[model samples]
Structures are given as C-alpha cells and as structure tokens.
Target: MTMRAVRLVPALIILLVALTCASLMIGSVSLSWIDLIKGFIRQDQTAALIIYDIRLPRTLLALSVGFVLGLSGAALQGLLRNPLADPALFGAPQAAALGAVLVLYTGTVEALSFALPVAALGGALLSVLLVLAVAGRVAGVTTLILAGLAVASLAAALTSIVINLSANPFAVTEIVFWLLGSFEDRSFRHVAMAAPFMVIGSLLLLRAGEPLRALTLGEETAESLGLSLVRERILIVLGVACALGGAVSVSGAIGFVGLVAPHLVRDAVKGDPKAVLLPAALVGAALTLSADMLARLVPAPTELKVGALTALMGVPFFLAIIARRRGAIAADAS
Candidate 1:
C-alpha cells in the first residue's frame, strides 16, 4: 500500500470509533459519555436500559447491515465491471422484500419470527438462479445485466400486486414500513437472526476477492490467468444475495449505501479493489449509522425512514455520476 493509503487506515479507524460512540450517545434521549460508559459496566440502571436495550442492538444492526451492503456492492460492481451495479440491480433486495411481505400479508410471519428472513433468503436465491438461468451458457456481463434487469422488474411488479391485494390494514401498514426501512425498536433478537447469513455471505465475498481482481482485465484475460469465470460469478451472486437478503429482511430496503459507499472508497483508494472493500464497509457503517441517527432525531417524536434519507442523498449523487460519465463519453467520442 502507498504511504497515503496507509495513512487513511488510521483515519478510517478513528472515524469509525467516533461514529460508533456518537451513535450510542446521540439518540432521542441523550446520554452523557459517563452514563454510556456506566451503562456498559452496569453502574447505572437508566443508562443500562437505554444502552443495552436500545442503542447497542441498533448500532450493531446498522454496522452488520452496512458491512454486508458495502461488501455486496463492491463484489457485484467488481463482478459486473460496472460501477453503477448494486445488489438491488440484480433483484435480490426486491425479491427478498417480496418474500417478507408475502409472509406478513398472509399473517404467517407472526407465528414464526424466522419466517421472514427465511422467505427473504428463498426469494433472493430464486432471483439469482433465475438471472443465471436466463443468461444461459457463455453469458457475458451485458447479458447478465439484462437478465438482472428483467428479474428486478418482475419481482417489483409482483411485490406491488401483493401489496395492492392485501386486505388487512395492519398488513398493509407493516408492508409499507418495511419498504421505507428503519432500525427503530430493533432488538438483539433481530441482530442474532441476521448475523449468521451475513457472516457467511461476507466470507464468500472475501474469498472471491482475488478472482475478482483478476477479472478487472476482462474474462478472457482472467481465464488466461486461470480464474474460473463461471465459479467466480456464481460465488459473487450468491454472496451478494445472501448478505443483502438478510439485511433487507431485517432492515427493509435501505438503499444507496451499497451503491454510494463502494464508489466513494474506490475513488479514495485509487481503484485498488482489495483495498477498497474494508474502507467501503467502514464508510457504509458510518453512512447508515448517521442516517439512522438522523431518522430518529429529525421531526422530533416522529421518525423519517432510513431508506428515504439514503435515497434523498443518493439520488443527486447518482445523477451527478451519470452526468459526468456522459460528459466523459461525449468527450471521448469527439
């Protein structure tokens, strides 16, 4: 690593630590640093309840979810050779959300807390399989992207239909909440529920890192370097789906962090794919944690959706990237 990159590591670590403490301390009811420290040590009951019950789990969930999304986005972007590619671009999140909605709208989720995550996993896996199947043999990046778009459109249409057909007001409200995304009232149980899948997914993506780096020069070049394109593609797709599915299942469709975080880190790190992953994950954690903090604090007692905040920030940034890319292409053409 360059000296500049090495310098960034310490800065990133400090930033992450600061963000974690801020997340723990700045909530609807503020807690002083001493109280926060005391809560962890069981020195104060009020501090204990607030820290243990509310802030800790929420912070952990945000970290875990952000890590998964950032890693997933980095992997997918690397695999597809498209900076704009996201886990959702492949229909994973939409399909997973649909699965959770199906269970909730049918009133089956209440009976089984694990049902929604399981259903979401199934939906995500199915979407990946469908995209691969449609792409068929000798599938190139363009074909895969087209196939993903088709699957995403289909999953979205199906989700809309389910929401529209649901009769229960409660179910509709629940579905809407899930779509908007929030970390409010999420407990350790939710953390425990999603951890395994996210961990597995992270491992899979990390394992593929070298192969993905080889792929940067193109499939033929990667193949010349003895990288199995097929296996790598499958691994990346499954890894992203597993990680992102668990996240969407738990937090409900928190968008843009996946797309934005990786890009920011890639630029900061000068496009070193391996170096980009962890920094992107840290940035993702920081972004989501800050957004969740804002979601709770904004509008006083009322909370804004975490996903809405991300989208609000992400859309303009996304547009700017698109515009710049277009301008670059035009210049090149000229």
Candidate 2:
C-alpha cells in the first residue's frame, strides 16, 4: 500500500467511530458523552434503557448494512468491470423486499422473528439463481446485467401487486414505509439475524479482490492466469445475495450507498477495486449513520426516511458521474 492508502484507512476508521458515537447520541433524547459513558457503564438506568433498547440496534444495523452494501458494490464492480455496478442492480434488494412483503401480506411477519429475514434471504437466493440461470455460465457482463434487470422488474411488479391487493390499509402502509427503508424501531433480533449473513458474504467478496485484479487484464488474460471466471462469478453473486438480502430484510431498500461509496474511495485507492472495498465500506457506514442521524435530528413532524435522505445525497453524485463518463466517451470518439 502507498503512504496515502495507509493513512486513508486509519482516517476512515476514525471517522466511522466518531459517526457511530454520534449516531448513538443524536436521537430524540440527545445524549451527551457522559450520558453515553454512564449508560454503557450502567451508572444510569434510564440512559442505559434508551441507549440499549432503542439506539444500539439501530446504529449497528446502519453500520452493518452500509458495510455490506459498500463492500458488495465494490466487489460487483470488480467482477463486472463496471464502476456503476451495485448489488441492488441485480434485484437482490427488491427480491428480498418482496419476500418480506409476502410475509407481511400473509400476516406472518408478526408471528416469528426469523420468518421475515429467512424469507427475504430465500428470495435473494432465488433471484441470484435466476440471474445465473438466465445469464448462463459463459455469458458476458452485459448479459448478466440484462438478466438482473428483468428479475428486478418482475420483483417490483409482484410487490406492487401485493400492495394493491392488500385489504388492511395499515398493513399496506407498513409495507410501503418499509420499502422506503429505515433503521427506526429495529431491535437486537434484527442485528442478530442479519449480521452473521453479512459477515459470511463479506468474507466471500473479500476473496474476490486478488482475482478481480487479474480480471482487469481482460477475461482471456485472467483465464491465462488460471482464474476461473465461472467460479468467480458465482462467488460474487452468492455474496451479494446473502449480504444485500440480509440488509434489505431489516432496513428495507436503502439505495445509492453501494453506487456512491466506491467512488468516494476509488481515487484514494488509485482505482484499484480490491483496495476500494474496505474504505468504501467505511465511507458507506459513515454515510448511512450520518443520514440516519439527519433523519432523526431534522425538524419534522416525523423522522425522515433514511432511504430518501440517501437518495437526495446520492442522486446528484450519480448524475455527475454519468455526465463525466459521457464527456469521456465523446472525447474518446473525437
């Protein structure tokens, strides 16, 4: 690693820690540093109750979900050699959301804690399988993207149908808000359910970095280096399915973090997708935590949706990247 890269990692880690503390303290109650210490140290029961029961899970959820999204995004981009690639682009989040909604629609969301995430995981796995099946073992990146788009569209359509057919207005409302994404009112159960899968997925994606570096030389070159394209593709797809599925199952459909996070750190890492993964994850966590804090702290009748806030922050970045790429293309053509 270069000197700048070595320095960047520590800086990002510090930023994440600061943001995490801020997330825990910036809720409706507005805890101070002493209050935070007292709460964790058990010197204050009320503060402890508030921190542990309400904020801890929410903070952890944001951190884990953001980390997974960023890492998966970086990994997917490496796999496809497309900077715009995101786990959500493959319909994993949409499919997972649909699965959770199915549980909600069937009135089983309340019955069991594990049911929602499990169903969502199942949906995500199915989407990955469908994409792989349609794209075929030897299909190119473009084909994989097209297959993913089809699955995403179908998942979205099915979710809409469920909403339309629901008899309970309240249930429909819950589902709608969930689709918008937030860490509000989440609990330790959610943390438990999602964290393990995210960790597993992250491990899988981290392994792709070396192979992805080889892939930068082109598929045939990578093959000459003895990197199995087929196996690599499967690793990334399954990793995304697990990580993104777990994230969406709990937080709903938070977007843009994956797409934006890698870009934030890409330059610092000298455009190495492998190097981008960890820093992107840290940036993603910081972004999500910051957004979640704003959602709570912003003066409103109700808390803003974190998903909406992220989109507001991310959309302009997305457009700017596209315009820059367009300019580059035009220049190349010229």
Candidate 3:
C-alpha cells in the first residue's frame, strides 16, 4: 500500500468518530457536554436513558446499515465494472420494499416481529435469482442490469398495487414511511435483528474482494487466473441482497449511501479497490449517521425522513456521475 492509502485510514477513523459524537450530541432535545459525559457514567438518569435507550441504538443501526450498504455497493460496482451499479439499481431495495409492503398491508408482520425482514430478504434473493436467470451468464453486465431493471419494475408495480388496494388507512402511511426510510423509534431489538445478517454479508463480500480485483482485467482474463466468474457473481449478488435487503427492511430505502460512500472512498484512496473497502464502510457509517442527525434536527419536531435527506443530497451526486460518464463516452467516441 502507498503512503497515501495508508493516510486514509486515520483520517477516516477520525471523521467517523467525530460524526458519531455529533450524532450523539445534537438532537431535538439538546444535551450539554456535561450531560453527555455524565450519561455515560450513569450519573444522569434522563441523559442515560436518552443516550442509551434512544440515540445509541439509532447510531449503531445507522453505522451498521451504512457499512452494509457501502460494502455491498462497492462489491456490486466491482463485480459489474460499472460505476452506476448498486444494490438499489439491481432491484434489491425495491424487492425488499415490496416484501415489507406485502407483510405490512396484510397485517402478517404485526404478529411476527421478524416477518418483515425475512420476507424482504426472500424478495431480494428472488429478484437476484430472476435477474441471473434472465442474464443467462454472469459475464454480461449489460444483460444483468437490464434484467434487474425488469425485476425492479415488476416489484414496483406490485408494491403500488398492494398500497392502493389496502383497506387499512394506516397501512398506506406505514408503507410510505418504510419506503421513505428513517431511524426514528428504532431500538436495540432492530439492532440485534440486523447485525448478524449484515456481518455475514460483509464477510462474504470481503472474501470476494481479491476476485473482484481480478475482474477489473476482464472476465476471461480473470477466469484465466482460475477465478470462477459465476461463483463470484452469485456470492456478490447474495451478499448485497442480504445486507441491503435487511437494511431496507429495517430502515426503509435509504438512498445514495451505497453509491456515494464507495465512490468517495475510491477517490480518497486513489482507486485501489482492495484498500477502499474499510474506508468506504467508515465513510458510509459517517454519512448515514450524520444524515440521520440532520433528518431529526432540520425540520424541528416534524423530522425529515432520513431517506429523503439522503436522496436530496445523493441525487445531485448521481447526476454528476451520469454527466461524467456521458462526457467520457463522448470523449471516447470523438
């Protein structure tokens, strides 16, 4: 690793810590530095309760979710060799949303606390499988993307139908909020629920990192290096589905963290794929935690949906990426 890549670690760690503190400190009900300090020491009941029972879990959830999204996004981009590729782009989030909507509207999830996430995971896996079936071969990124688009469209249509036909007045609202995304009212239970899946997904992706790096040289060349393109693609898709689907199931479709985090880290690390993973995860955690903080504070008591905030910030970045890609293509053609 170069010195520049080495420098990113400390900087990212510092940034993550600062953002985490900012997340804990600033909220609707402001707490002083003393209160914050005392809360950790158990010297202040209200402070401890707010910090431990509410903010801490939310922060942890944001961190975990962000880590998963970032890693998944990086893995997807690496696997497909497309900067635009992400879990959301490939129908994972849409399918997960559809699953959650089904359970929420049918009132099945109300009885089973974990049903929503399980269904969402299943939907994500199903979408990936469908996309793979349609693509026929994992070597074709173009075909895979198109397949994902088709699956996403289908999932969206189904979700809309479910929302429209629901008789329960609250069902629509719940679905909308889940789609919009937020960390509000999230507890340790949610943290516990999502942690294992996210961890496993991260490990799976991490293990595939070396092969993904080899894929940069083209699939045939990578295959010549003894890497199984099919196995790598399947692992990547499954890892993304598990991590991103579980995240959306719990936090809704928090957009742009996956897209933005990995790109930012790649820039920071000078485009070394292997070196970018952990930094991407840290940047993702910081982005989500900071965004969650602003989502809570920006609209006062109204509380902007975290997804909306991320979208608001992310969309412009996405457009810029599109513009850059277009410019590059034009340059190449010229």
Candidate 4:
C-alpha cells in the first residue's frame, strides 16, 4: 500500500468509531458517555436498558449493513467493471423487500417464525439468479447492466403493487416503512439475524479482488492465470445477494451507500478494487451511521426516512459522476 493509503485507513477507522459514539448519544432519550460506560461496566439497569438494548443494535446494524453495502458495492463494481453498479441496481434489496412484504401482507409474517428473512433471502437469491441467467446468455458488460436494471425495475414495481393491494391498514403502514428503510426500533435479534449472513457474504466478496485485478488483463489472460470466470461470477453474485438480502431484511431498503462508498475511498486505494473494499467499508460505516444520526436528530417530530436522505445525497452525486463521464466522452470524441 502507498503511504497515503495506509494513512487513510486509520483515519477512516477513527471516524467510524466517532460516528458510532455520536449515534449512541443522540436518540430521543440522550445518553451520556458516562452513562454508556456505567451501563456496560457497572450494569446500571435503566442506563443499561436504554444504552445496550436500544441504541447498540441500531448502531451495530448501521455499521454492519453499511460495511456490507460498501463491500458489496466495491465487489460488484469490480465484477462488472462498472462504478455505477450497486445492490439496488441488481434488484436484490427490492426483491428482498418484496419477499418480506409478501409474507407480511399475507398475514404470515408473524405466524411463521423466521419467515421475513427467509422470504427475503429467497427473493434476493431469485433475482440474482435471474440476472445471472440473463446476463450469462449475453457476452458483454452492457447486457449485464441492462439485465440487472430490468430486474430491479420489475421487483420495485412488484413491491409497490403488493403494498397497494394490502387491505390491512397496519400492513400497508409496515410495508411503507420497509420501503423507506430505517434502523429505528431495531433490536439485538435484527443484529443477530443480519450480522452472520453479512460476514459470510463479505468473505466471499473480498476474495474477488485479486481475481478481479487479473480480469482487467482480459478474459484470456485471467483464465491463463487460472481464474475461473464462472466461479468468480458465481461467488460475487451470491455474495452480494446474501449480504444485501440480509441487510434489507433487517433495515428495509437503505440505498446509495454502496454506490457512493467505493468512490469515497477510490483515491486512497488508487483505483484498485481489491484495496478499495476495506476502506470503502470503513467510510461506508461512518457515512451511514452519520446519516442515521441525522435522520433522528433532524428536528422533525417524526424522524426522516434514512433511505430518503441517502437518495437525496446520492442521486446528485450519481448525476455529477454521469455528467463528468459525459464530458469525458465528449472530450474523447473531439
């Protein structure tokens, strides 16, 4: 690693820690550092109840899901060689949300234990498989992107329709909340459900970096280096599906962190996707935790949807990137 990159890692880690603490402190019932310490160390019941039971899960959820989104984003970008690629682009989160909604709207969400996450995983896996099946039939990056985009649109439409058809007022409200995505009222159960799947998926995706670099030399060269294209593709697709699915199952449909996180650390990683994963994850954690904090602290009686804020920030950033790319294309054409 370059000196600059090494320096960047520590700074990002510190920032993540700071953001996490800030998040823990800013809830409806504010928590002091001493109280947090007393809660954990001295087992003060009320302080412990508020700090450990309430805030910790949300903080952890934000951190882990952020890492997963960023890691999956960097990994997917490496796989597709497209910086714009993200979990949302592939329909994983939308599909997962759809799955959760189906279970909820049908009145089975609570009846079947583990139904919410299982259905979500199934939906995400199905979407990934569909995208892969379609893209595999073609022979280019453009086809892959188009396939993912189509699936995402379809899944999102289906999710909206499901919400629309829900007769129960409470079910409709729940579905709407999931679509907007937040970490509010989250618990340790959510953390437990999401963390393991995310870790497994992250392990699989992190392995892609070296092979992805080899792939930059072309399929023939990468193959000659013993990189199996089929295996690489499967790992990344499955990895992203699992990580993103787990995240959405717990947090609803938080977006843009994946698309934006990698770019935040691209300079530190010197555009090497392999080196980008860890830093992107760290920055993503910091960024997401900060966003969640802002969502709660925004002075509105009701908290802002974390998803909405992310889109507000991310959409403009995405547009700016597109504009820059357009300018570059025009410059090249001239």
Candidate 5:
C-alpha cells in the first residue's frame, strides 16, 4: 500500500469506531459510556441487554451492510465504467427484496429460514442480469440509468402487488418493512444469517480489484493483460447478489450507501478501483451507522426509515451526477 493509503486507513478505522460508539449511545434510552463499561466489566443485565440484544445487532448490521454495499458500488462503477453506478441505482436490492417478499409473503416462510436469503439472492442475480441486458451490449450511462429505473420500478410494483394481495395483515406489514429497509428489531440471528454472505461477497469483490483496475483501460487492454471479462463480470454480479441479497433479506432495502460511499473515497484512492474497496467499505460503515443513528433520533412517535432518509439526502447527489453525465454526453456529441 502507498504511504498515503496506509496513513488514511488507520484514520478511517478510528472514525468508524467512533461512529459505532455513537450509534450504540444514541438510541431511545440514551446509553452512557459508564453504562457500556459497566455492561462489559460488571455484567449489568439491563445495559447488556440494551447493548448486546438491541443496539449491537443493528449497529453490526449497519456496518456489515455498509461495507458490502460500498465494496459492491466501487466494483460496479469499475465494471460499468460509470461514476454513478451502484447496486441501488441498478435496482439490485429491490429485486432481492422482491425475492424475500415472494418467500415471506404473509410471513409464509420464516424470516430466519434459509429460503429467504436464497430466494433474495436469486432475485438480485436476476435483476442485475436484466439491467445488463436492458442496458444492451454498448449502452451509455443515461441508457443504463433509465433501464435500471425501469427494472426497479417494475420490481417495486410487483412487490406492492404481492403485499396488496396478501390476506394476512401481518404479511403485508412484513413485506412493507422489507420494501422500506430499516435496521430496527433485527437480532443476532440476522447477524449470523448475513455474515457468511458479507464475508464471501466482500472477498469476491476485493479479489476482482486487479481485473477491475485493468478494465479501467478498456476491455482490449485488460484482455491483453490476462484479465477475463467473463470472470470479472461473474465475480461482480455474484458478489453483489450474495452480499446485497443477504443484507436486504435481513434489513430491507437500504439504498444509496453504495452510491455515496465509494464516491466519498474515490479521490483518496487516486481513482483506483482496486484500492478503493477498503476505504469505501469503511466510509460506508460510518455512513450507515450514522444514518441509523439519525433514524433513531428523529423525534416522532415512530422513527423514519433509514432508506427514506438516504433517498432524501442522496437525491441532490444523484441530480449532480446526472448533470455531469449530461455534460459528458454533450461533449461527446460535440
């Protein structure tokens, strides 16, 4: 690693740790450092239950999901060679949510069942493939974005239809929660279910860094450098599908971390897709944890969905990206 990166990484780790502690502290009950230290050292049951049973899982899920999303986004932007590319932008998580909805409609399948994540993975894979297909063999950034929007809308519509047709009100509620995406009420069981996917998927995306870096120079040059386009595509798609599907299965469809996280670290990595994954993951973890914290702190009878908050904040960034894309397209045309 470069000296700059080595220096940056420790700082990022410290930031993530600080944000995690903040997440642990800023909840409905408002925990103190003393409570946490006592919880750990003296085994205080009340503090332990709040930290261990409640906040910890949500915090961990935020971190894991954020890391996976960040890794996937950076890898995807590399694959598509588009600054705006992300799993959420491409509707991958919506598809995964659809898969979960199909399995758990009316809570028909247990939320903890293996079938939930498997179906979500299948859905995510299908969505990504369709996006690729719709974008065509040589699609522009605008075309890819439009295609993803269409696919996402369609998937969301189907998901709503499933919810509307449900005879069970509980099932409708479950499906709606999955659609909105939040970390509330998750448990260690969720952490366990999603951990394997996060680990494996992170590895797959991290491994693709070399090929992704090579591809930045275009396919022909990458191929000449012994990069297999097919292999790279498979790793990107499957890595995203597994990690994102698992995450959505547990936490619904938290969007925009993939969009926001990688971009935050792009300059730090000197625009190297290969080097951006770790930094992006760290930033993503911090972002998600912070957002989840806000979701809790929002003063309403019920907290806001983290997904909605991200959408609200990220729309401006999305529009800026579109403006940039339009300028690039205009320049190309000229």
Candidate 6:
C-alpha cells in the first residue's frame, strides 16, 4: 500500500468508529455518553435494553452490510473494468428482495424466522446463475451486464406483481415498508443470520484481489499470465451473490453504498482496485452508519428509512460521476 492508502485506512476506521458510536446514541430517545456507558455496564436496564437489544444489532448490521456492499462493489468494478459497477447491478438485491417478498406473501415469515433470509438468498443465487447462463461461458463485460439487467428487470416485475396481487392488505403494507429498507427494530438474530454469509462472501471477494490486478492489464493479457477467466468470474459472482445477497436479505434494498463507496476511496488508493477494496469497505461502513444515524435523528419520532437517506445522498454523487466520465470521454474524443 502507498502512503496515501495507509493514511486512508486509519482515517476511515476512525470515522467508522465515530459513526458507530453516534448510531448507538441517536434514536427515538437519544442517549448521552453516560447512559451509553451505563447501558454497556448493564446498570440501566432501560438504556441497556435500548442499546443492546435494539440499537446494537442495527448498528452492527449497518456496518457489516455496508462493508460487504463496498467490498463486493470494488471487486465487481475490478472484475468488469467498469467504474460504474455496483453490487446491485447484477440484480442480487432485487432478486433477494423478491425472495423475501414471496416469504412475506406466503405468510411463512411469521412462522419461521429464517424463512425470509433463506428465500432471499435463494433468489439472489438464482439471479446470479441466470446472469451467468445467459451471458455464456465466453461472454464479455457488455454481455454480462446486459444479462444482469434483463434478470433484474424480470425479478422486479415479478416483485411488483406479487405486491399488487396480494389479498392481504396488512401483508402488502409490511412488504412495502420492508422493501423501503430500514435498520429499525432489527435484533441480534438478524446480525447472526447474515454474518456468516457476509464473512464468506468477503473472503471470496478478497481472494479475487490479485487476479483483479492482473485483469487491469486486460483479460487477454491476464489469461497469458495464467489466470483462469472462468474461475475468476465464478468466484466474483458467488462472492457477490453471498455477500450482497445476505445484506439484502436482512436490510432490504439499501442502494448506492456499493456504487459510491469505491469511488470515494479510489483516488486515495491510487485507483488500484486491489487497494481500493479495504478502504472502500471502511468508507461504506462509515456511510451506512452515518446514514442510519441521520435516518434516526432527522425524523425523530418518525424515522426515515435508511435506504431513502442513502439514495438521497448517493444520487447526486452518482450523477456527478457520470458527468465526469462523460467529460473525460469527450475530452478523449476531442
């Protein structure tokens, strides 16, 4: 790592820590530092319940899910050699949401706690498989992206159909709210359920780092260097499916952290995709925690969905990136 990257990591870690603490403190009834400490000590039962049972899991989910999204995003960008690549670009989130929606619609979510996430994971994996099959073994980036888009559209349409055709108004309401995405009232069970998948997915993505570096030199060159494009592609798809799939299973469709996080830290990492992974993940954690805090603080008694806040923050950045890339292309053509 370069000096800039070395500096960036610590900076991001500090920011993440601060945001985590803030997330713990900001909620319907904000707690002071003393209350937070007392809650940790278990001296204040009310504060303890609020902190441990309520806020902690939400905070943990924000951090882990954000990290997974960022890491997956960086890996995809590297694998595809596209700065615009996001975890959701492959339709994992939408398909995962569809899975959860099906569970909710079927009323199985009430009977089985694991049903939602399991269904979501199945959906996410299915989307990835569809993308891979449609793109074919020797497909290029454009083909893969197109395949992803098609799958995503189909999944989304199905999700809407499920929502529209639902007979139970309560289920529809619950599904709609869940789809909006929030860390509200999430328990440690959610954290535990999603943790393993996220960890495995993260490891898989990290393993792609060296190959991604080789890929930067072009696929033909990387293949000449003895890299297996097929293996690399499978590794990335599975990693994304697991990591992002797990995240979406728990958190619904929290958008743009994957897309924005990598760009924020790419410059500090000297545009090295390998170096970008860790820092982008840190940035992603910070962003999610910060957004969660804002979602709590902004509306006070009426909390905003964490996903909504992220989209509001991320959309401008996304547009700016597109404009910057457009300008660069124009300049190149000139």
Candidate lDDT (C-alpha), each: 0.80, 0.83, 0.80, 0.81, 0.84, 0.83
Compute each candidate's TM-score over C-alphas: 0.90, 0.91, 0.92, 0.91, 0.96, 0.91
Candidate 2 — which residues are off by over 4 angstroms?
108-112, 128-150, 327-334
Instruction: Answer with 5 or 6, whichever has the higher lDDT.
Output: 5
Which portions of model 1 show Cα errors greater than 4 Å?
A: 128-150, 327-334
Model 1 agreement with the true structure over 24-135: per-residue lDDT tens digits: 9987789899998999899999989998899999989888888888888788777766686666667778788888888878776672387778788888888877876886
Identify the candidate with maximal TM-score.
5
lDDT of 3 by residue, 104-136 (tens): 778666723677777888888888777767766
Q: Write the per-residue lDDT of candidate 6 for residues 221-295, one digit (tens) a residue.
A: 899999998899888888887887678878988888988999998988899989999998888888888888888
Clashing pairs in 4: none
RMSD, candidate 6, Å: 2.8
Q: Please give, for residues 1-334, the per-residue lDDT of candidate 5 as tens digits.
A: 5667777779999998889888888888987999887765647788888988899999999999888888888888888887888898778999999888888875667879878888888888899899998897455677788889998998999998988888887877767766787999889999999888778888888888889899888877888998888878888899989988888888889888888888888887788888888898888888888888889998988778888877776778878777867878665344
Model 3 regions lying over 4 Å from their true place:
132-147, 327-334
lDDT of 3 at 106: 80
Query: Mind sharing the TM-score for model 2?
Result: 0.91
Cα lDDT, model 5, residue 291: 84
Model 2 pairs whose backbones collide: none
Pairs that collide, model 6? none
Model 5: ten consecutive residues of lowest lDDT: 325-334
